[model samples]
Target chain A: MRIKVKFHSLLRLYLGFGEMILELPDRQDITVRELIDELNLRVGKELKNKLLDGDEIKKGTMVLLNGKNILHLKKLDTVVQDGDVVVFFPPGGGG
Target chain B: MKSELSMFQRQIELLGTDCQSKIADTVILVAGIGGLGSVVAESLVRFGVQKIYIVDNGLIDAPDLNRQILYTYKDIGRPKVLVAKERLSSINPSCEIVPMDEKISESFELPNDVDGVADCLDNFADRFTLAELAWNKGIFLVHGGINGFWGQITSIVPNKSPKMKDLFAGVDEERQQVQVIMPTSGIVALLQSLEIVKLICGIEPNLIGKLLLIDLLNYDFDKIEV
Candidate 1:
C-alpha cells in the first residue's frame, strides 16, 4: 500500500518541498504516529521532531486526511490505508 | 458619466431592491489594512458598500508592494489605514471610508451598527482580539487566513458559531513560525469579502460553520468541518 504525505512551513524546510508518496506494507495498517516514525527513520532526526514531539505532534501543524482534519477525526491513532493522502500543514500565524 | 452603481447592477438584480438597499447602507470594519484587508476593502468599495472602517497600525513598506495593491510608490512610509481609506474613497467617493488608525488591542470596540467585520489582520493576537470583540457584540465576522498556497475562510456569527479559538487552539504563539504566501492572501480576502456580502444580504454562506481550504498547488478545494 502507498500513501501520500505532505510537509508545510518550517517542517518543509526540514522535510523539503511539499508532498511525497510512501510505500507501506499492505494488510499492516499503522497509526499516524507510526507513519511519522517511518518518515523520521527515512528522513533523519531533525525532520522527525519538526512533525512529531515525544509521542505526539507539536500541536501546531494541522494534519489532514482527505479533506478532514485528523484532530476532529482521531488525533494520531487515525488509521491510514493504501492511497490515502495525508497533509501536514503548520498554519502560519501571521494573519 | 456612468453611474458608479452600474458596476453593481448584476448584484443588485440578485439581491433585489430591499437587500441591495440594505447592503448599500451597511458599514463594514476591516481590521488590518494590509495584504488581505486592502484587497477586501477595495472589493467592498467597488461593489458599492456605502461605508467601511479600516483599522490598522501598520505602515506601508517595501515588502508590501507585492500584493497590497491599494498602495504605491508615492504612498510608501504612510499609515496603512490612512492610505487605504484615501484609495478606497477615491475608488468610490459616494461611500464613506473611516480610518481607525490604530492597532487591534484589548481596547478595540466595535461600533454597534457595523454590519460585518473582515478579519484581514496579520497577527493572531489582533485576529483573536477582533474576533472575540465582534463575537461579544453579536456581529458577523468573516475570517480570512492564508499561507504558502494554502488558505481558509470562515464566517463567525458570535454565539451561534464555533469560536475561532476552539478550531485553532494555540496558533497565536506560532504566528512567526508560519510562512506567508502572496496569492493565498488575495484569494482568501476575496472569499472573505464575498462572505461579507452574503451576510449583509441575508444569504446563506458556504463557509458559515465550515472552513474552505484551498490548496493552490494541487488545485484542490476542500472544506474542513469546524
Candidate 2:
C-alpha cells in the first residue's frame, strides 16, 4: 500500500524531509502505531524520540488522514487501506 | 444580482423574516487579513453581510501561500488588506469593503460604526490588544485559533459575557507560539463566521461561553465550558 506522509513545524527538522510518498507493507489492516514504528526505524532513533515518547507518538503532534483527523478516528488503531494520505503536523499555538 | 433574499428564504422561514433582515443589514469588522481572518471575511460576505472592515498590515509571502487562501502568486508582495478587499468586493459588491491597511496596535482606533469584530490575529499580544479595544468600545468579538490538530473558536462580549482573557488566563506572551494547519484554520474560521452571523441575527451562538476544541487527528469535536 502507498501512503502519503506529511511533516510540519519543528518536526520537519528531524524528519529531514517535508513530505514523502512511500510504499508500506501490504496488510489487510494496519494501525497508526504499526506505521509509526516503521517510520521510527526509517527516521532513526534520535529523530524518532523527538516525535515519539517511548512507544507512543506525542499528543502535541497531529496525524490526519486525507482531510479527516485521526483523533476523530480510532487514534493509533485507526485502520488504513490502500492510497490513504496521512499528514503529520506540529501546529504553532501562540496565535 | 437579485436580492438572494430567496437564497436566505429557508432561514427566514425558520427564524422569521424580521431577524433575517437584521442579518442582511449588519456590518462586521474582521481584524486581520491572514489565514483565519481572510476565510472569516469571505464566509461572512457569502452569507450576505452588508458591510465588512478588513484590518491588516502584512504583505503576502511564500509561507502565507500555504494557508492564506485569499492571495495567489501575483499577490506575493502586495498588502494583504488591499488584496482581501479586492477579492471580497468581487465576491459580493453589495457589501461595502472598508480596508484599514494598518496593524492592530494598542493605539488603534476602531471605527465607531461597525457592529462586531472577528479576531483572527496570529499572535496573542495583538489579540489581547484588539480584545481590550473592542471591549472598551462595546463590540462583540469572535475569536478563533488553530494549531496542528487542535483548534478553538469562541465569542466574547467583554464585560457583558465571560471574558476570554480570564478563561485562557495567565498566558505569557513571550512563550506563546502559534502553529497553524490549513484544514484546522479553515474550519475554525468558518465557525467564527457562523458565530458572527448568529450574533448579527440576535441568535444564541454555540461557543458564546465555551471553547470548541477540535482534534483533527482523532476527528473529535469537544467543547470546554468556561
Candidate 3:
C-alpha cells in the first residue's frame, strides 16, 4: 500500500521536504503510529522528537488522515489505507 | 436613507441593497481586541454591522503596537477594549460598540442577541472556550490565528461542522507566545471579518468544515477539508 504525506509550516522546515509517498508492505494493516516510526528513520531524531512523545503524537501537532483529523478517529492508532492523503502541521495559536 | 446609502455606496453596490441591509442588521461579538480582533472589529463597523461586542482583558503595551493597529503609543497603559471601542465608534458612529474588559473562559457567558462570534484570541484555551460558547449558543464562529508568516481561517456553523476542540484535539493548551508579523495578522483578521459578513449576508461561506491554510513565506494558499 502507498500513502501520500504532506508537511506544512515548521514541520516542512524540520523535515526538509514538503511531501513524500511511502510504499508499505501490503501484508499487514499499518496504523499511524507505525507510519510515524518509519518517518523517524527518514527525517532523523530532531524532527522525530518535535512530532512524537514516547510513541504518542506530541500536542500542538495536527495529524490529518485524508484531510480529516486523526484525533477524531483514533489518535495515532487510526488505520491508513492505500492512496490516503495524510497531512501534518502545527496550527498557529497567536492572534 | 439615500444619504446613509451614500456612506457605503461601494460596498452596497457589491453586496446589493438586500444583503447590505442584512449586514447592517447583524450583531457580532469579537473576542480579544488584540492583533486580529482589532482589525476584525474595525472591518465589521466599516461594513455597516449594526452592533459589535468587543472583549479583551489586556492592557496595551509597547510590544502590542507592532501588530495591534487599533492602539497607539499613548494607549500603552490603557485597556484594549476601551481603546478599540473609542476608535471603532469614531470610524462608524451609528454602529453600536459594546466593550467588555473581561477575559473569556469556561465561566464566560455570551449575550443572547449575538448573531456571530469571532475567535481572535491569542491562545488555544480561550479559542476553545469561545468556540464552545458559540456552539452552545447555536451561532456562527469565525476563527483566525497567526504565527510569523503562517495563519489559518475557518468558519464553524453550529451543528453543521465539527467543534474546534474536536478538530484540534491534540493541540497544546499552553499559550505559546510567538512572533507574528504585522501583515500576517492584518490579513488573517480581514479574512475572518469577510467570513462573518458572508455568514450574515446569507451567502455561501467558503470555509465551513474546511481550513484555509495561508503561507505568506511561500506565497501558498491551500484549503483542506476537515
Candidate 4:
C-alpha cells in the first residue's frame, strides 16, 4: 500500500519537491503524525518546525486528506488508509 | 456603433453581446477595497457589470499604494470604499457603484439583489464570516488571496459541496500585515473577476470546486481540486 503526500503553496516552495509516495506495507492505519515522521526520514527534510508548533498544526498550515481538511477530522491523530492522498499547504491569507 | 457597443467594444468583441448583456444586468458585491478588491472591482466595472456594492472600513495607507490601484498618492488617508467608488465610477459612469462604509461583521447583511460576491478580504476571520453568509444567502463567491509571490483563486457556488470556510477552517489570521506584490494581487484578483463574469453570464466557471494556485516566482500555475 502507498499513501501519496502532496505539498502546495509555501510548503511546496520550502520543501523543493512537491510530492512523495510512501509505501506502507501491510499497514491499515497510520496516523498523520507517523506519516510526517516517515516523510521526513525519506526526504531528509525536517518539516516538524515548519509544519507544526507544539503538536498542533501551525496557524496557517493545512493538512488535507482526500480533499477533506484534517481540522474537520482528528487533527494529527487522524487515521490514514492506503492510497489516500494527503495534501499540505499554508494558504495565502491576504488580498 | 451604439453607445454601449462603443463603450465596451473590445470586451464585447471577445465575450459577445450576450455575455456583455449579462454582465450589465448582474449586481455584484466586492467585499474589500484592498489589493485584490481594488483590482477585482475595477475589472468588473470594465467588464460592464452595471451594479456593484463595495464594502470596506479601512483608510488607505501609504503602503497600500503599492498594489491598490484604486487609490493614488493624493488619495491616501481617505476611506477606501469612498475612494474606490469614485475611481470605479470614473472608469465607467454607467456602473452603479454603492459604497458600504462598514466592515463585513457578523451583523453585515448581503443584499438580496447581489448575484455574486468577490471575496477579496485580507483576513481569515472576516472571510469565514462572509463566506458563511454568502453560502447561506445562496450567492456565488469568487475568492482571491495573495501573500508574497503566491496567490490563489477559487469560485464557491452555493450548490457546491465544499465552501471556502470548510476548506480553510482553523487557519488563523496573520499577526502582522501580509506581504503582497502588485502583480500577484492583480493577477489573482483579475482571475477572480473573470470567474465572477463567467458566473454572471451563465457560463460554467472553471474554478468551482477547484483552486487555481499561482506562483509568480517560478511562474507555475496549478489548478487543484479542493
Candidate 5:
C-alpha cells in the first residue's frame, strides 16, 4: 500500500523533509500510530518525541488523515486506507 | 470636504465602488496589539475598514520595539491598545477606532456590532477563546501566528468551516515564549489583514477551511486543506 505523508509548519522542519511516500506491507489497513512509527523510522528522527506522547499527539501538533484531524476520529488508532494522505502539522502557537 | 471615495481613490479604481462600500460597512475586532495585531490593524485602517475595535491589555515591552510598529521605545510600559488606537486613528481620521483594554477570555464580552475578528493573540488559549466568541457571534475569524521564520494563517467562518477549536483540538493552551523575526510577523499579519479584507469585500478568501504555512527560511509557501 502506498500512503503519502506530508509535514507542515514545525514538523516539516523537524522531519527535514516536507513530504514522503511510504510503501508499506500490503495490509488491508494500518492505524495512524503505526504510520507515524514507520515514518519516524524512515526519517531516522525521533519525531514521536516531538509529535506524540503515547497515543495522544503532543501539544501543538496535529495529525490529519486526508484533511480531517485524526483526534476527531480514533486518535492514533484511526485506520488508514491505501493511497491515503496524512499530514503532520504543528500549528504555530505564537503571534 | 474630501469625498471618502477620493481618499481610497487608488484602491477604489481597482476594486471598484461596490467592494469599497462593503469594506466601509464592515466592522472588525482586532484582538491583539502586538506584532500581528500591529500590522493587521494598521493595514485595516489603511484599507478603509471604517470601523475597528482593538483589544489588548498588554503593556509595551522592550522586546516589542522590534516588531510592534505602533509603539516605540518611548511608549514602553504604556497600554498597547491605547497606542494602537492613536496610531490607527492618525492613519485614517474618519475611521472609528475603539480601544478595549482587556484580555480575551470566557468572561470578556465581544462588541455587539463586531462583524469579524482578527485572531492575533499571542497564545493559543486566547486564540481559541476569541475564535469561539466570534463563532458564537456568527462572524468570521482570521487567524495568524508566527514563530521564528515560520507562520500560519487560516480563516474560520461560521457554518462554512470547522471550528478553530476542533481543528486545533489537540493544541495545549500552555503559553510559551516564542521567537519571531520582524518580517515573519509582518508577512503573516498582512495576509491576515488581506483575508479579512477579502471576506469583507465579498471576495472569497483562500484561507477559509485551509491553513497557509510559510517557511521564510526556505522561501516556501504551502496551503494544506484542513
Candidate 6:
C-alpha cells in the first residue's frame, strides 16, 4: 500500500520536504499512529519531536487524513487506507 | 446621517435588500480586538451589521499599529475595546458597538442574542474556549489565525462540522509572542468577516467544514476539508 503525505508551514520547514509517497507493506490496516512512526524514521528525531510529544501529537499541529481531521475520527488510531493523502500542518496561533 | 438604504448602497446593490436586511438584523461577537478582531469588527460596521459585541482586555501598544487598523497613534495606551468602540461607532453610528474589556476564559459568557462569533484570539487555548462557547450556544463560528506569512480561516457550524479543538488537539498554546505580518492579518480578518456576512445572508460560506490555508510567502491557497 502507498500513501501520499504532504507537509505544510513549519512542518515543511522542519522536514525539508513538502510531499512524499511512502510504500508500506500491504496489510489489513495501518493506523495514523503507525504511519507517524514510519514518518518519524524518515524525517528523523528533531522533526519527530515537533510533530509528537511522548506519543501525543504536538499542540497546534493538525493532522488531516484525506482532508478530514484524524481527531474527528479515531485520532492517532484512525485507519489510513492505500492512496490516502495525509497532511500535517500547524495552523498559526497568532491573530 | 445617511439614509439607511444609501448608507449601505454599494453592498445593497450586491446583496440585495433582503439579504442586506438579514445582515443588518444579525448580531455578531468579535473576540479579541487586536490584529484580526479590529479589522473584523470594522468590516462588520462598514457592512451595516446592526450590532457587534467586542471583547478584549489589552491596551493599544505602539507595535499594534502595524496591523490593528482600528487604532491610531493617539489610541496607544488606551484600552483596545474602548478605542474599537469609538472607531466602529464612527464608521456606522447606527450600528451598536457593545465593548467588553475582558479576556476570554472558561467562564466567559456569550450573549444569548449573538447570531455568530468571530474567533480572532491569538492563542489556541482561548480559541478552543471560544469554539466550545459557540458550540454550546449552537451558533456559527468563523475562526482566523495568522503568524507571519501563514494564516488559516475556517467556519464551524456546530453539529455540522468538526470542532476547532478537535482540529487543533494537542497543539500547545503559544508561550511567546508570535510574529504577525500586517497584510496577512488583514487578509485573514477580512475573510472571517466575509464568512460572517455570508452566514447571515444565507449564502454558503467558503470554508464551512474546511480550512483555508494561506501561504503568502509562496502564494499558495489550499482548502482542505475537515
Per-residue C-alpha lDDT of model 6 across residues B70-114, encoded as one tens digit per residue: 999998899999989999998778899999999999999999999
- On residues A52-85, what C-alpha lDDT tens digit does candidate 6 reach at each position? 7677777678898887777778978899988899
- Cα lDDT tens digits, model 3, B55-155, are 99999999999989899999999999899988998987888999999999998899988999999998998899899999999999999988888898989
lDDT of 5: 0.87
Cα RMSD, each candidate:
4.0, 10.5, 1.6, 1.9, 1.4, 2.3
State which candidate has the highest DockQ: 3
TM-score for candidate 4 = 0.93
List iRMS (one decimal) for every candidate.
3.5, 9.2, 0.8, 1.5, 1.2, 1.7
TM-score of each: 0.80, 0.68, 0.95, 0.93, 0.96, 0.91
Put down candidate 1 lDDT per residue, B105-163, tens digits, no spaces. 89878977787899987767677778889888778888887776777788888766677
Best by TM-score: 5
The CA lDDT at B210 in model 4 is 86
The docking quality of candidate 2, as DockQ, is 0.11
Q: Between which residue pairs do clashes occur in model 6?
A: A59-B170, A59-B171, A59-B172, A60-B171
Error of 5 at B2 (Å): 2.0
- lDDT value, residue B187 of candidate 2: 85
Candidate 4 has an fnat equal to 0.67
Q: Write the per-residue lDDT of candidate 4 for residues A1-93, one digit (tens) a residue.
A: 789898877788788977788898878779998888888777777887788888888888888888788989999999999889898877888
Q: Between the candidate structures 1 and 6, which one is better when assessed by lDDT?
A: 6
Model 2 clash count equals 18
Candidate 2 lDDT score at position B95: 76
In candidate 5, what are the lDDT values of residues B1-226, reduced to their tens digit? 2766578999998888898888988999998889999999999988899999999899999999989989988898999888888888888889999999988889998888999999998888888888888999999999998878888899999988889989888876767788888899999999999999888876864688898888888788888787
lDDT by residue (B82-174, candidate 4, tens digit) is 999899999888789999999998999998898889999988888888988999988888888888988888888877758888888878764
- Per-model CA lDDT versus the true structure: 0.77, 0.73, 0.88, 0.86, 0.87, 0.87
Residue-level lDDT tens digits of model 3 in A21-69: 9888753558888888788787665667878888778888999998788
